[model samples]
Target chain A: MIKPLTGNYAAAWGARLARVGVVSAYPITPQTTIVEKLAEFIERGEMDARIIRVESEHSALSAAWGAALGGVRAFTATASHGLLYMHEMLWWAAGSRIPLVMAVVTRTIGPPWNIWTDHSDIMGQRDTGWLIMMSEHNQEVLDSIIQMFKISEDPKVFLPGIVGLDGFILSHTTEPVDIPDQDVVDRFLPERRQPYILKPGDPLIMGNIPSDLRDNVKMRWDIHRSQERAKGVIRDVDREWAKLTGRSYGGLVERYRCDNAKYHIIGMGAWVGDMKEAVDILRDMGYGIGLVKVRYVRPFPGEEIAETLASSKGVIVFDRSVSPGSAGPLYLDVLSHAYIHGVRVPIQNVLAGIAGIDVGYDDIIGGVTMFINALEEGRWPLPSKIQWYFGGGEWWP
Target chain B: MSTERYLPLARPVVGVSGKTGTWRIERPVINYSKCIKCGLCWLYCPDNVIEIVEGSAEYVKIDYDYCKGCGICSNVCPTKAISMVPEG
Candidate 1:
């Protein structure tokens, strides 16, 4: 049935439909409603899952890890600092190769004390070996959570995953979501499988100290291999979901209007929606621009990105977060891939929407026009470094 | 069906640290003549080096090769039948 739901509610519905066995998470802004709705589900007996009341984000994920280790599908939700607090357990959960899913509502990491949306928090966790999925809207948020369980619990790719939605933008905003029937979802998702289950008589130690150092190194390699394998699994699962639900999200990165364009605008999370609109307007104004909205950032769509952007004259990468002193994370990934693919065309970074400054289609149109205009003039469209685009609507040097 | 895991998983086993008795500078001596087979030493051995035999007069046995001479067993034995002695 189609219903109006916030991004947080959509996430809660996704976990509910997937029949998550445990919900253990501390409440953080923008992420609080997700667990709040889940608590209501458990209270009303609409969902048959246990909610673990924990004092901190660390305990929340540790509890979920134990539940998943004990052979139950577990889930949790957090935003910003809550995600940062779960850092150690994040490594522990993925390193143990236990399958669980988390909903990360992207929020600003604060010293200035802002509760707005940004990708800095989730992007900071890019190297921790967990499968990361960033969604542009509420529907994808709900849909990917279900798919995340399938992908993570697959024996071929048994790593923990986080599905991210931009805080307040998607998390608090209402959107129409098709909540799939439990029967259809049941057919799509199977019973959560673990490499091994902890039992009373048969004891097993997970993440135990290895006897050989090379074995520890091998396990790290296993995580990397599984991640590579997950790219294929993610594609296959997206195809299956599209087949079943008629809602294809283009797997790793959704290619929008890239078929006959001179430039492609690449981004992830909520701003991708605006980027699409800007692409249309820019095309109307006669600048050949398209959109490549990233879905899965971990098993990054390198091949897909290379194939789409190689023939283009130039590429502009939009990063909601930067690595502080270095280039934007998404720009770095796209640049490396483009170089490897031998696409000499300039790929530039435009750091917009840091700490949730409102960026609309007009801002995207103005910024991208400046890029294409620069290209037409045979001048460097962007400097080697990025300046935060707060020009009110202008793309900067 | 090979039931190996995808990660470095360790199962419960004896001598996970590799017969740590090799690191011992002393040995635990169990005196069967003290005549108490109370099994406290077997129960308290940190390394599980002490064992109990139901059918033999040597009701309690110690695997000195892996004992590590921690004296945990000797300290816990109520009958004081096991003592830690300096090794050559």
Candidate 2:
């Protein structure tokens, strides 16, 4: 059934279908509706679950961790400062191999008290051992949440997965979403497995206990192995979901007409939707341009990316976050992977959006021009080191 | 399975002293006069560290070398055939 809902409502419905027993999250802008709807569901007796109103994001994650350890399906959502506040527990949840799902509304990490869409909040937490998935539309945000539970709870990949939707852009905007039937969801996602249970009668020690360096290394290696295993599980889950729901994800990174194209544009989150329109405009002008929407960022999708960019003459990587002295994070990953694959494609790195700055079509066109010029000149574009600003002013153009 | 699953720590290997199986709580000696066909010690040892003597009056034997001092056999012995002793 097609229901008109905001991205936050989609996320709430997905969590509801997953039958999350405990939800412990403090409200932050753009992400508050997810928990609010969940609380409403519980109050109306529509959903049989515990909805906790925690004091802070830190306590929210801590409570979710405890509930998950007790062998119950759990979830939480946060944005910007809430995500930053829960940073320590993020590592704790992943390290303990608790299969909890978190919705991260992409917002700028603040010093100036801004609450708008930006990738820095989630991007800054790239090393938190969680499998991160970016949502392009409200539908993806909804579906990704349900799929995240299955992906995270897989025994081979017992790490947490975070679904990221741009705050205000996707979270607040309403769109058409297919809310799966409850019976269908129950068939797709059976009860979560309790292999690592923490029963009161059968006591077991949880995380942060003292252990030898070798034990610690073993734990870390398993965490790395789980992330690597998640790469394959993510693809497999997408394939399976397509069979059940008649909807399929493009897997890892979704490619758009890049097979025979000479120039490919790369980005994540809501920008990809804008880039799609831009790709069509460039394509009609006979520019041979395409787009690669990076849905999964942490696993990096190196092999698939290398193959996608292999035949392209040039590639432009649009980053939403910046590194102080180096190329943006996305640029480094794509360039490094391309180099390893022996592909000599010129990569133009463009730092377009930062600190909630709106990335317009002009920025996209300028980025494409740089990429084409680099290819024509037979030179790999230098790593992006520009800082964009407001007031129509130039700082590092 | 990866090598990491067997060892809780990331190291390659651990020495025998680190192995918890070598410590013993009780040492059993065969008493033929009190021996019966009942194999209570062999059935009750949690670590499966007990052995039964074959065709020698069905006496029960405990392998003290691998026991971890978890006293289950002594408590389960119905004939007072086994006793718990501290291992130095």
Top candidate (TM-score): 1
Standalone chain B TM-score for every prediction? 0.80, 0.61
Candidate 2: the clashing residue pairs are A214-B9, A214-B10, A214-B11, A215-B9, A215-B10, A218-B10, B25-B69
Please state the error at residue A382 of candidate 2 in Å: 6.7
Q: Give candidate 2's error at residue A136 in angstroms.
A: 0.2
> Could you tell me the lDDT of residue A373 within candidate 1?
78
Q: Report, for candidate 2, the interface RMSD.
A: 7.4
lDDT by residue for model 1 over A13-41, one digit each (tens)? 99999999899999889899999999999
Task: Looking at model 1 chain A, report the run of 10 residues with the lowest lDDT sum.
Answer: A379-388
> lDDT of candidate 2 vs native?
0.81
**Worst lDDT 10-window in candidate 2 chain A:** A386-395
lDDT of 1 at A268: 95
Q: Give the residue spans of candidate 1 off by over 4 A.
A: A381-385, A391-397, B1-6, B19-88
Q: Say which docking band candidate 2 falls in.
A: incorrect
